[model samples]
Target chain A: MTDWLDHLLILPILLPLAVAAVLIPINERDRTLKGAIGFASTLVVFILSMILMRLAAAGTGSLPGSGVYQLGNWPAPFGIVLVLDRLSALMLCLTSGLALAAQAYSMARWHTAGHHFHSLFQLLVAGLNGAFLTGDLFNLFVFFEMMLAASYGLLLHGSGPLRVKAGLHYIAVNLAASALFLIGVSLIYGAAGTLNMADLATKLAALEPRSRTLVEMGSAILGVAFLVKAGMWPLSFWLPTAYAAATPPVAGVFAVLTKVGIYVIIRLHLLVFGTAAGASSGFGQEWLVTGGMLTIAFGGIGVLASQAMGRLAGYSVLVSSGTLLAAVGLGHDGMLAGALFYLVSSTLTIGAFFLLIELVERGRDAGADVLAVTMEAYGDFDEDEEEEEVGAAIPGTMAVLGLCFCLCALLLAGLPPLSGFIAKFALISGLFDMPAAELATAMSAADWTYVTLLILSGLAAMIAMNRIGIRTFWASIEGTIPRVVVIEITPVVVLLGACIFLSLQAGPAMRYMQATADDLLAPLTHSERVLSAPRAGSQ
Target chain B: MELILSAGIGTLTASGVYLLLRPRTYQVIIGLSLLSFAVNLFIFGMGRLRVNAPPILDPGGVGDLARYTDPVPQALVLTAIVIGFAMTALFLVVLLASRGFTGTDHVDGREQRGD
Candidate 1:
């Protein structure tokens, strides 16, 4: 079972870790070298991840279920195993792509804002990749901690009053989440006598009713930890402020962090408790759907209420998360596939928009400049106009910024001619189609509610974005063209370009997502693959 | 034994939750540490509070679940402890930085009216 290809599964987790460890000691003055090492590492990860994706597509390694890599050849239920399934592969690819873009964007200036930006960023990637690939529940907790620790460092990277305040709340919430995670894992192990996810799923299916109740309680607590990370409402009050406070590139990479929570929820819930769990089958299904709907509705309200662009962007993340979480709750392969597509679209757009906000705001005064624009209508603006005109450097910068913001607006609102629209369309179609047998009767109120929320949320985003876009771009008396370097602009374009590519290739993308959803819902083969894979380090 | 362990965990968590709800940064940090301790012990108890058991078997040997305490949760707890320690340090540093920057040790970094 041991082959050359077996090593590829670990590369995504290890390579970034190695690079980060190497970079940590190099003088802070040697930022150039750090950038080179960081860029090369991320690029290689992206490449390696793409190769893994190809392998996943072609069905290599231990897959058709999952490709299992035991860390030290100790076999399943005994050792830490890394799994490369369709879902994990897709997430790895997404993380690498976001890391590359965020890194490129940071190299222009954002990297200099902190002491060890590149190191922390790389570590964050390593943690994310580890989280996605690890096959044990406890390892999942460890990776979650790693990722959260890195994020705490990154969140406070560029220390300012706002950043510090937001970082405190962020730290507190996640620390609590981590504690819950430990308790959950421990309780489950106590009940089932296993830590491996596959083994747990198998064990959970046959557990006695009383013990199954205990496991369900543990899992519900576990779900709270993940839901908080995923930015579920009631537990997500800290999200907007924390996101709005972080530096652009950090915030951009943090886009995928929320999705990481979603990924685990989708993976864990369906696999452990889907059709297989006796008495506990679909244990948290009602809560997931109800809570997801509430979160979506609340996210829509937040989007409408946000006055600042950064805050708006933060709320956009909530909407994106809520959309995906609700779709996952639907428990239909079609809805999950559509949700997956939308997840990719929304994350890319939000990441790109976060990076764009800083660049677009660089030449303006604080957000009050828009207020200054309104004041100009009452005749007190010529001095500000002259200052802005003097600061203006690039003729095309304003046009480019406007165009990019428009595209982001379109994507975030799930508007047409782009991937966001296609994603929303697919999801709506699936909402109705997911319950094919029920189609003979009248459409359920829940289905109608989801459709209405999706449309209403889209409208909310469009209106808020248009309002900000007009205030920030059109209403401004002074045209201060943001002096953006190619390095900064390129990343935004590349990310947005991915959105365009996804739109054009929606058919194939949906097919891949549908396959991932199928793999997730029926994961017995995946569990078997992990249990049967030969120990790592063994010939 | 289960009763005693659960009682201890309950006390730790109850006190942790109480402190966690307090407004001061130091209180919250202590609360977090207490909570982590409770969690760590909880994890330790998950291996069934065995007094003497063989650790993880020598590599390449089959594991006999009956003869050994489950090493997986032990390994998991060890990793969790290390991570928890790192998080506590990070939180403390951030707490200090926040206190210095905001001129208050309040959790929100601003004083409340009544408090």
Candidate 2:
């Protein structure tokens, strides 16, 4: 039974791949079958993720500390290993849950958009799960490309002028980032003499200072690649435009995209970089925190300037990016715990908002002028031509939209009685308690800058919320009552319920995040487990 | 050899930066390619230049193990080359598609946005 749970780690990744492969050969005309498969696969992934999370919480004694599945039974350091720790498990659960919701939302709404939607969605899930679980750096790059390729197809699934335009830039920027990632990995391998993350951690400390310096530089370059993916400052200009152009279901699922980058950074920081308090340590906690603060500030400003609801939601993601990175940068166990907790809550909240954006767009004829013409040629919108399009805030949809907005506000503002507030408070309190004479003192000016930036960003989000929310929801507009589709509403309600649950059950959530953080902070136990695995030929 | 490689890297960086600033999409693509080549070489060099020695583990291998060239970088470069090729191909396809769809190949996709 315990061994079976370790195999469960691979299921979240495999289920989607299996479904996608099976569905590809089937006729594209069978939209019902495709939707059924897509929904079922995503649900299974979510359930499997929950089981993995439970196993992770049970500790290494119950299961392997880091569940490593060797493909074809090849020994470690040679074949591909799918690793699942608490961090990966948490991310997998969040991603799968969000994906499940998004797929449900798309069923009745986007079914006829194209036959490729279901397949691409499954591939995206497979890639995301693979990226989260893979232990090999090269495999990580492979999964990243896979995810990007599927994303390209999905991003351009509807094939509109605006979507294509946005998709082109998005593809270009990500390709550039991919190139940089490869180069950085090559450099690290050159210096460290290994690609296995565990091996790198062990070998890096023994290298000459100059060699170490080269590796560190390589790591920073790689860091830039992840930061670009995370929608960090300066490199993130392409995000809002691209995300806003995507379909609501696609856009909502993509809210987790930047989180993948942050996840990679956090993993590498804890496992490979060696987060020791010394000059020799390559852990860039300070850099991450500073960059995070800048991202938060930039995201807040972007939200303020955004005219559309989708773009506003996109900016909200950027704000959360800053908060997550800052918490990680604080370099305390409590801060890391808080950041992880925030990660789960924000992912759910953002996913919900993305779904709402789709529902709101559905009520209006807004899709016609912007997305309809490009899509009309493809023959998906004619059947629904007779139906009257509602205004941006049809009464029934407005209520759900309002609830979504409140959730978004709670998340962005980090308000109390919500998961966002709890996560932020935990992180802020941890920062305040750090010894005064530590690195916090050396970087006091920068520290204070982040503190002020974070507080101000929250306030800015509130103000932006008022500016956008009031106009979209409260202002008078003339239109018929749009039919509120259950498929769309169900997903939003499900994700909203999740946010509420997390907020309500903050105690256990906080404890689990803390345990995960502790595991990262002191990885000696994890290292010992890997080393303890019987040596080849010795056995 | 080291000086020449350094000069090549510098030239690549400068040319890439210049092309990136250009309004034309093709030039930007060329710049990206040049930059990738420079970065690949830079990463390879970080393992310390060894002309004859291979990183294979053998009792009969020449020189002390410590003095041998690092194989890790080679493995990394191999993967990097593959990924880089995939990206370059993807970008080329996208650039061509953008040209076909938008009827322009400017950096910003739209000529007016360049202003």
Candidate 3:
């Protein structure tokens, strides 16, 4: 490998951190300046992620699976490390794509609402990229803290009563979750005697049966922390409230945050406890599958029950997380590949939907105290907007909004001709095709429940989205046309446009996703590559 | 020594859980803080609680795992402490903000009209 390409792994985490720091000293009033710099930086992130994705797909080194980048020239189990494989690279590309759209949307006005908006946004991206790239368990905790801290700031960026209340709950819940994270990590470290993920995988492989129970308990506690972030049922009471309360762009970026939880679950569950785990293999699959199904059921109910646009988008996030979590739990490699595809498609769709909410709600009378607070938080005085309906504003906006709303509805509901349907088809079809095990000829009752809930949730999303779509578009014939900026509408189109592109290229995309699933399930490759590397430290 | 340390962590955790279950925001925040302290101690204890052995090794020795405390958990606990501190500050600000806005410090931000 060439020198620069060898350094590509660290750039994703470093570039965003550098840009965020540079943005900090710039004066807050320079919106145009900050927007330009942030956009350029995020665009670079997107391009770099794409390049890295291709590099990761075709092997970069002697290791057939991943290229481990040792930080500070310290290698293996000794020091901080970053790993770039198909999964993290795919996640990086997805994150930057979402960040690009959200940053563009923010430039129109949302970035000006509160203090340090651009800085917080960039830091959020940095944290996310770091979380995806880190190879060690302690580094994962540090990155998780970084991500959650940035999210807390971004969630309350606009600062209103609802945002404050929701942000308070959000911070409190996450703080407690962090405590659980520390406990779980410490327990696992104590039991396993290592913090590097690859090293832990090796250690757990040979762990005695007596301590196997202890390690299992640690992993289970750790799973609880991740599931809470994933918005699983019974632990997700705070998710919808917080997501709905966040500003449009913040909510857009946040669509990927819940997926971060799912990403960790997929990576760790398969790597640490896959077939290598000897007796502990397939640990917590039952809770994961059952809890994931219940979360989908709850999210479906929330989708049906929600009367507002933002809340619906929030529940849609829960639905996506639930689907992926349950698919991973099934432990079918084929279905997991399908879940990867679903993860990307659903995140893009819901992020676009979150951005679309503020635009759709723009034309209507501000609903209640909470919403009126949101309007003020968004920093537009209604009295001023009432007097000035600029004649030059795009008259095609309502039509565009209507089209985007319909597309989001189709995608979220997993209707045909969209990637959502293809993803779900792959997952459900792959479920029954699992290789022969005990009683393998017949579908289990759990499988049936998964299929039923999957279809029912899609139906619920379709109905709820139809209701909201009608309420926003058809019911607005007599209302004033909402004045949307070109910058704002472009992001919605580009995001939804990506979903359309996914549908068109589903053949190649599914192949790549399946490859990713294959890579994730086989732990020996990761452990071998990590441990066999020449130590970059004093050795 | 192990017994004393584990008992202390247990007591802190029990109190923390008790406070975390309460309705008031301040109490819950304190609960989270106390809970984090317990976790921090647990992490510290995970390193085997060496009395005098910091991780710095003699120049002649390499890979002598028994001579020093494990520096990894100590580092992990340090990172946790910093993050936990920031979280507490953020929660405190939000606590005041929510209290100012809702007129009640209830964690839910709403008062029960009948109760």
Candidate 4:
């Protein structure tokens, strides 16, 4: 039993992949069977991730379960290894949780739109888990490609003209990014002489200046690829369009996809270029802070400029990514903890929003939004009153959807009474209040810019959500109440309910997040554990 | 020899970038393929150019360590090639679908007025 537990780290990556392969050969007509197996697999992975998270939270000392699982009983820094600490475990649990909701939401008619939806979805989860858990730079690239391949299929699922168009651009841009990824990875390999992250951390400190410069240039290029995925402005023009055009359930899972980029950035940047890395300690820190603020500004403007609900949700994803990026660049332990909290809450909200948009837009005429926008642009007229007469009473479904929309809006805009507010509060306070006396410097110009942009972006989301909400729910001239299924709306409720739960349990969650932040800040301890883990049976 | 390899990578990259910015989808696909090829070579060259050396270690332990090439980049290049090939196939299919769906070969699915 203990031996089996020692191998628990591999299950999150392996289980979904096995299930996906099994699902691929099954008949697409066996929808019920496929759905059941997929959901069961995701649930089990979620539970496993939770167990792993608990183990990680307990501490790495004397724990055989949560540290490192070497493949084929090979030693670390030689064979591929999976390391489970607080951060990766948190990500695994979050991915599976979102997968459960997304898989459930897809069963309500979206699965029948195309073949292999369940298989691709499972593959996506497996790829995400692998990317999060792998401790090797090359392995990260492999998992990233796997994730991208699955995403390309999912984005092109439910083939429409719009989807095909967006799919072309998305594929092209990502291919270019992949090329860059290879260049960076190989460049780093050339300079560091080892691919294992822990091994590199030790080797990098002793590198000559010329090779270190080469490695930094490689990392900078690598950062571009990640930033493109994280939706940092300019590089992020493809994100909103591609995400908006995706089928809702796929888009819902995609809410966590951008976070993969942010994850790698935080992981590699801190692990490779941390305080112990001699002269390159703060390399790319300024770039991250500045680019993150710009992303927030761009996403805020995009949110306001967007006329479609799907695009609004997509831009919200950018806003979420930007906030996390800036928080990551700040390098404050408390701020990182708050950023992790914000990551969980905001991802869930944006995912629920994406799924809800499909159900809400179901009964409305295709061009009704365009008409509404044009009408608003032309100014209020007597026609508005006659349109108001068309509304008599709110149906039960519309009422529930409106309520969910309000919850999502409040969460996205960081309003009071939800986890979003708590996360932002924790984050801002964490920025201001330092735990150590020496680190308690006054807020710099950049910090103030970040705070100002953060608040302004939230305000922009509020205005956009309010405007779109009114147009969607109340002021529509020809809008009919969308008939939503119980299964469809339940996932949204569950996701929002999770946010409320997080808000209520803010104390424990923050503690866990702060612990994660501490672990992240202290990279040496992580490298030490990973590098020193014994081979199987040798211990 | 080093200069030649570098020049080859540079030319491929330049051509790929130029084609990538073209207005047509097929050109973009070809450009991506070229760019991936350039990257694969770059990754391979990162292991350092050696005249005649085995990438694998001899079980007899007779070979000098310095004469052996770094096997990691070779392995990495193989993975990169496989992924890049798969991606190119996918992009081709998507390109065809896009071409058929909108009845145009332009990257944006329709020809813009000015372009």
Candidate 5:
């Protein structure tokens, strides 16, 4: 790696932190300046993430600075370390991309609703970047707390009665989860005698049976903490309500927050309890698969039951998280690649949908949804029904919004001609496609169940989206056109446009995801790279 | 020493979990604080409850694991405490705001029908 590029590993976290610090002292009245600063820094981080992704793709263990970065010139296994690889870079890229959209969308109006919106948003980004990049388990705890703190502030942004109510539940639940996190981390440290993840991976292989069981117990508790955030079944009651109550931009970025939980689960589970870990390999895999399947089923029900668009969007996030979790538990390389693809596509689509919901809901009555559901239930009981032509003269803004809504529905439902379809297709094919040596065996029942649940969830999303979309666009033609700014709508377009681009470039994107999966599956190589990397000033 | 410490942690955690399931927001906040306290003590115990052992290295350039009380847990506990304190403050503020907004302290922001 080049000297300059070597330092780039930390910039994603630092730039956001520095920008947030600068924005903190600025008056809340200087909304434009704060928004501008936040946007500029986010754009820079996005660009840097792109470059790092390219670097990670090209390096492949041969190039310098491609993997492990030690902080403060300290050697790994003893000091703070950050690992930059295909997966981390991809997550960073996803985060910054979502942040840029949210920041832009927030500037239109939501940023003005609160004090220090830009600072909180930037801090949230910094926390996310830190969580994604850090290599130490305890360091992960700190970053997770940082991220949760910022999310608390952001979720409470634009506070009203509903937001305050939902924020209370969100805060309380996450606080409990954080307590669980500390216990898990401490137990792991006690058993393994190290906090660095790479070192833990190495140590786990040599641990005695009793200590291995202790470590496994710790990790299972740790997994529970993450599953709470990931919105798994029976642990996700707060998600739909809290997410629905948040402001659009905050909710948009919040879509990625659940993925962070899934990210840590995948990272730690594979690294610490991977094939090399004697007596502990593949621990908790059954729980993940079962919990994930149940989550999908629950999310599907939530989607169908939701009369409100915001809650629908929230449930969609649960479905997305569940799909990724189940795929990760399967431990197949092909399925993992497809899951990564689905993660990106669904995140972007959901982010755009959240932003678009506020716009779509702008001109309608607050009670319109309840009224519509009632009318639909009781055979259109309203006396003054319009018998005119169904197609009204759509304004340009409404036209664009309708198109975006259609795309979002298509993406969320995994319909044809979009990245969602390709992702689901890849996942299904990967599940059934065993190696040539095992061609005699048929698909397992678990695989069959996963495929059935996946399709059913998509169908539920399709039905719910169609119902809501028709109610908003076609049935409610009498509603006024919302006065949307160019700034607000542009982010939605950019996000949905990115989905289109992903579909168009499916070949290369799939290849990248496959490579990332290859890197993730091989925990031995990953740990070796992290543990063997020299200190910055040494050698 | 381990017995006493573990028993203390167990008691705190049990009380904390009970309080956390309460409906009032204030109780929830207290529960969270209690939980954090228990977790901090538990983490502190993860260093094996060493007594009269130096957390720092000896000046004579001898570094031995048997002589040193593991300082990493102390650092971890400190971080957890700081974050826990900040989170408690934030949660309290939210609780007050929700109370003010909804005129209730019930976790649902409204009292149940029978209650």
Candidate 6:
């Protein structure tokens, strides 16, 4: 049973790749067979991920230390390694669950979208799982590209002028980021003489101070590339546009795209850069915290300004990015736990919101004239015609849209009794407990800025939700309402149910998050545990 | 040697950033390629400069660890190069497709959409 769990780590990635290969020979016109294989495979992967989660929770020490399955039995530091720890397991589960639900939604929505959907969807899953599990920097790059390639296909799954336009920018930005990532990785390897993360961790510390400084600078530049992928502010301009133009199911799964970037940042920061002796070291914790705060501010403003449901959901993802980054910046185990907890909640909530956007769009074509007429009826028609046009939801999708809007609002606004509030409270409380030694050296201005920014961002999110929610959901309009289809409602309902379940299971989830965070903060325990195990094929 | 490599990296970074900010998509692609080259060189250099020594161990060599340049970065760079090529190809394909579909090569398709 325990050995089985070790094998399960590879299944999530492998299943998708196998299915993708098998589906290629089938005619693209065979939508039924394609849909069946796609949905079933994703479902199986989801179940396997759940089993891995259970095994991880049971604390089965199958391979001893954190499990590292080196491909081809090659020794660590020489060959590629797929590491499965509590964090990776958690991410795999979230990704699989979301992928499964998105597939289910796509089955009905993309009946005519062609067979490329299944292949792209499966490849995306493979890429994500690979990214999560890879132990080497170079493998991480490979997986990132794999994921991006699949995303390009998925983004344009339903080809249209808007999608093509948005996708071009998305591709351009990400290509630039990939290039930067390649450059950064090369620079780091050149300086450090190792690409294996654990080895880099050990070697990075022993390098000269100047070299160490260069490595840190290189790491920060790499960090920017991931940040762009994660949709952090200043670099996030491409996100909302691209996300808005993508099909709902693709957009729903794509919500996890930026989280992958956040995952890499957390992994690298905690594993490699966390070893710096002093808090003020070049790659120290302060920069992450400051950047996170700035991201939160920018995300909150973007959310407020967004008129379209799809764009608003996209901005909400950006806000979540800020929160998670800030938590990483704090560099405390508890803060990271809070961040991780929030990560799960935000992914679920944002994914659900994307699905709901499809429902809203399908309900009514919110044309400019219709919006203008409605605004005229309300006697407050001063907003731009485009803005008015974008806000108009189809009449029939109103109920579903309202429900999803409420769920999104509750999660994003951090209202109590929901996962969002609990996650936020945990992070804020963790920040509050920073030790005197850590706090005393910080400038008072920076501290105040941090607290004020967090609070203000939270407030702005609530205000935006209220304003947008009232207009988009509660407002009554006269129009021809299209019927709400089962395909659109099912995934949103399933994800909303998950949001509720996670909120209810907050106790255990938070505990797991804390354990994962502790492992990250004290990576020596992880490194020693993983390294002590004999390599496969070693006597 | 190190100074020259460092200068090259700086020049690459500058050129890449400049081209990336350009309005045309093809220039951005070129910038990205140049940047990747610089980065690959940078990582290779990190293993420290060795004129002729490779990482392969001699069969009858003694237990001295200092003779070889580190092999790990080389392995990493090798993987990076292949993956980089794949990603660049994907981007180039996307650029071509965008040009075909929209009939323009602007970084942002907004101007073309307006027209």
What fraction of the correct interface contacts does each predicted structure contain?
0.96, 0.51, 0.91, 0.98, 1.00, 0.74
Interface RMSD of each: 0.8, 2.3, 0.9, 0.5, 0.5, 2.3
Error of 5 at A477 (Å): 6.0
Residues B1-115 of candidate 2 have per-residue lDDT tens digits of: 8898889888987897687667777987887787778777776776677788777767865567666787766666676667677777867877777788878888666797435
lDDT of 2 by residue, A355-387 (tens): 787665555655333233233346554455535
Looking at chain B only, the TM-scores across the models are 0.88, 0.84, 0.89, 0.94, 0.93, 0.89
In angstroms, how far off is A246's CA in candidate 4? 0.5
Worst 10 residues of 6 chain B by lDDT: B106-115
lDDT tens digits, residue span A1-539, model 5: 46866788899999999999999999888899989999999999999999889988876564355467788878788899999989999999999999999999999989988899999999999999999999998899889988999999999999999999999999999999999998999999999899898889889989998888889989988899999999999899999999999999999999999999999998988888778787888899888989999999999999999989999999999999899899888776669889999999999999999999999999788888877777788877644666664466788988989999999999999999999999999999888777777744666677888999999999999999998898898778456888899999999999999999999999999999999888888888898899889776565
Can you tell me the DockQ of model 4? 0.94
lDDT over C-alpha atoms for residue A140 of model 6: 91
- Higher TM-score: candidate 2 or 4? 4
For candidate 4, lDDT tens digit of each residue in A1-539? Answer: 58888878898989999999999999999998999999999999999999888888898764573389888878788888888889998999899999899999999889888999998998999999999999998899999998999999999999999999999899899889988888998999888778898888777889999999988998999999999889897799999999999999999999999999999998888888887788988789888888898899999999998888999998999999999888888776668888999999999999999999998889787776666667678986645456545538888998999999999999999999999999999889888885566443667888888889989999999999998889888776565777788999999999999999999999999999999888888889889989888887774
Candidate 1 displacement at residue B99 in angstroms: 1.2
Q: What's model 4's overall lDDT?
A: 0.89
Q: Tell me which residue pairs clash in candidate 5.
A: none
Question: Can you write out model 6's per-residue Cα lDDT over A406-495, one digit (the tens) per residue?
Answer: 877888788887888887787777766667787766435655666677667767778767765665554434333546678768888889
Q: DockQ for all models, in order?
A: 0.84, 0.45, 0.82, 0.94, 0.95, 0.56
- Clashes (N, CA, C under 3 Å) per candidate: 2, 1, 0, 0, 0, 6
- Model 1: per-residue Cα lDDT at residue A108: 90
- In Å, residue A40's CA in model 3 sits off its true spot by 1.0
Candidate 1 ranges beyond 4 A from true positions: A60-66, A369-394, A434-442, A535-539, B51-68
Please give the C-alpha DockQ score of model 5: 0.95
Best by lDDT: 5
DockQ leader? 5
lDDT of 3 at A20: 86
Residue range B1-115, candidate 3, lDDT tens digits? 9899999999999999999988899999899999999999999998888887867777887766667779888888888888888888888998999999889988888876653
